[model samples]
Target: MYFSIEPKTSKEDLFNFDEPYAALKKCIGLNEERLVVVFGLRRTGKTSLMKVVYNELDMPKIYIDAREIFPLTPLSTNQYLVSIFIEFARKYDIIKAILEHVSAVEFVLRAEGKEREAILSSILKNINAEMQKRKTHLVIFIDEAQLLKPTGADRLLAYIYDNLKHIQIVVAGSEIGILEEFAGQNKNASLFGRAKKQITLNRLRPEQSFLFLKKGFAQAKKQISEKELMAAITEIDGIVGWLSMYGWHYLKIGSKKALETIVKDGSKIIADELEAFLSYRGEARRRYLIMLRTLSIREMRWNELKRTLELEEKKKINDSHISNYIEALVNYGFIEKEGINYKLADPLLKRGLDFVKI
Candidate 1:
């Protein structure tokens, strides 16, 4: 049977680009420079971007996805560092063996009151020791990397980046705001003033979405009307995951009415997410989410949003407060703005707002 959701092939998965190779080339060009901050709203293809660019670099590379190793939410920065390094040691044999050897030194150093620093300090020493013995360069990538607790990660990254000549380190995450929050401008901090390059991964434009849809339908041996295809794109606002879901939904429905149902059903998924946002505690956050939802459905002027807020009987929110709410939302990565206009940065959120009652 043909599949609608098979892992998009490396070539076909280039979702939004007529020339993904060119995009990959731009990313590869960054390798000659210092750290590149690869970030985007969740599922805007940040990880895919990393994979494509990293593939071009011919080096001994390691990709560590932090999502796989759950972040310790309650831990302090120092404690988090210990946990992260322990996890790192347990997984990579070369790093593990090197650390184990350093633990011997650590045990001795503990008696001299240097045990705390010994683990991290000696790990670096061991990396150099290994490099001399093995004669190779190391490129390490940490994914979902925004989750790394700021305090400890700052110190660790700074030390590694400052000292390690042979190891090229790259950190990427789905949430750009989270990373910016982590890398605050404290000179003593790990990544302070250290991001040599920053890259933003956004959704495929409308034209790119059309191309991907056509390519995907051909692969699945299905044909879609231009109206149906454009409807899906408008509904999902050009997010790849939602586009793929539309393709999957289109394949299962045989009738035109069934197609309408798929769109309606998808809208409900959007609505549920919107309800969750509005109901979430923090009045400013709720208002911001609601405002973004409204913007997604139809553009509203500043005073118009105030008027709309006043009309809501259940939501006793203030018109003047909307600006502050929008600022907070933008800071926290929930929404984005261009001049006076603003909208939900994530398309799924847009669908959820569409599901919300007028």
Candidate 2:
């Protein structure tokens, strides 16, 4: 199931995390609760690792994907928490009895007046009390939590974490912008400085990447040529999500064009994120595209990047403008700083240079 291109929610598919798992076990140990945030770039196994930890922890849990509930089809905060409550009730037999009296959860889904807020809060408190009685932690996990809106959910979470000792809120976000701006280092955000622990997942090293592919293929009852697979790993760059996609394709066609799979199928997903990062810039899209393309080729100092953009735009770009762009790109995960130089985080993104223009 590690080779599954679709979502894999089981711990059995988890790999290379004896250290991270153990650390998380210590962080979220019995009654040692805090708001935990797991962050990383796309294709890293943030969700899978959380599931692995979830399986190990003996607690009542609900995993809500903000990507589904927030963007594209936005859900109000009431509806969001109500869904979590429903899932928790469904998972625990004891909560099913309380579910019958939870008319407010159903009513607040459509109506969000002050009265509704109080009603929903009371219900969450009631559920919290029941969880405490059972001596099991009430863990609510929100994946892609960057998509979560500023609906005072954090205030509610802060209230719960401070008062309801049995409740724990763990969120994971793949986009750096969402994670940082929403909860990390940002002083003004609700959960800022409140995350009990923060864990970042990085791409596997070369040897680990090889073993990951080998084991994933074995899990799927398929085989891959060692040479071709290594070449594919080079192309995929230790991104497990893309590897899963490539393996899914390899099983069908028996081909070794993992780079092709990444560029063709995965381009839009990456481009969409980049575009989302540059969404606020009105006339600077072309500059960003040219700069990203330039860095994709090689790392460049600030002066060099500014000169490249000047030549590309056929207009003078001030030093401050280019510096701001570089900083923003680095912060948003498109560009990484190496010493005093900057380069695209994923060189594979160069293949979609055209998409960046729009």
Candidate 3:
């Protein structure tokens, strides 16, 4: 009752939900040429933050989920060009204004499957012209941005980072390591040699979470003990999504022993989420995830991973195969490398992985 866990539609509600709002304001103020990459694990509420910022600002904004635009499969360059045009159509007179600047408007309209670099160049020029006239910066927030790699448009991102002077782009994805992979370690990589601002979304602290639950409980005219709050927070480890589900459970049960029920139900909920994530992945991914979980208990070196694999019941892992598995896992946001050591990307996911295994 009176809980705020849904997608935030307004500015005030979004800022008040969680995390520091002041820092967001500061980030928005820095509308430099460099694209700001805001990424975290799944369910970290990056989309909510973008929606809030867009609503607060008066500038014309366009938000798209890159997952929909760019899936796991490869897409033609023409298709990429079309998606950009389609997204711009949402804003009034935006597309029309762009088309007005180009002399070969019919050429862009008629282009089919594959096209020349010239057509793409013309489209970019018109769009850039429209962007300049508005003096109103465009914020393109791409959710699930890792989906774009298969399209080979990862370089297109570099193009935008280098050329788009008027638009302030913000790309968000669940996979931190993979997104960085697209950005590449090379100096020529777009956004390479440029300062990157990373914002990590961690779970709520126990005190803050308890305060939230207490406030909600008070509003519902129900009383809950400090012990109960502590117990619930400990079980969920202050994950907002899990905590919100627990609140929902408490509201339904309304029992003196709500804490125990909430913990039981919360574990099931977390397990269900893990199952959904794991279901889509393969055995190699699973093994990689388990390896990450093992490392999470304590940091593991490359040699240690090799030794652990060698001690396996039967098969020995090849270096290439191991590298590929590790890359896929890291790309999907399951495993992370700190120098030569590795760990799970999120501690909550680590706990869920550990719990689900048994």
Best by lDDT: 2
Count of backbone collisions in candidate 1: 3
The global Cα lDDT (0 to 1) of model 3 is: 0.61
Which clashing pairs does model 2 show?
none
lDDT assessment of candidate 1: 0.59
As for TM-score, the candidate ahead, 2 or 3, is: 2
Worst 10 residues of 2 by lDDT: 66-75
- In Å, residue 25's CA in model 2 sits off its true spot by 3.2
| Cα error, candidate 1, residue 102 (Å) | 6.4
- How would you encode candidate 2's per-residue C-alpha lDDT over 1-358 as one tens digit per residue? 7777766566667677666666666766356556777877776888887777776677677777766654333236667677668667766866665665467666776665666667666767778788877876788777877666455556566677777777787888776765666664677776666646777788788898899889988887776689977888777677777877777778766774555766676777787778787788878877888889888778899899999988877889888898778877876677777798887776567765667765
What tens digits encode model 1's per-residue C-alpha lDDT throughout 186-269? 465467777555666677789988887888788888877888778767766666755666677677765365446546665676
Best by TM-score: 2
Superposition TM-score, candidate 3 onto the true structure: 0.74
Score each candidate by Cα lDDT.
0.59, 0.73, 0.61
- Structural similarity to truth (TM-score) of each candidate: 0.72, 0.85, 0.74
C-alpha lDDT of residue 244 in model 3:
60
Tell me the lDDT of model 2 at 165.
Answer: 78
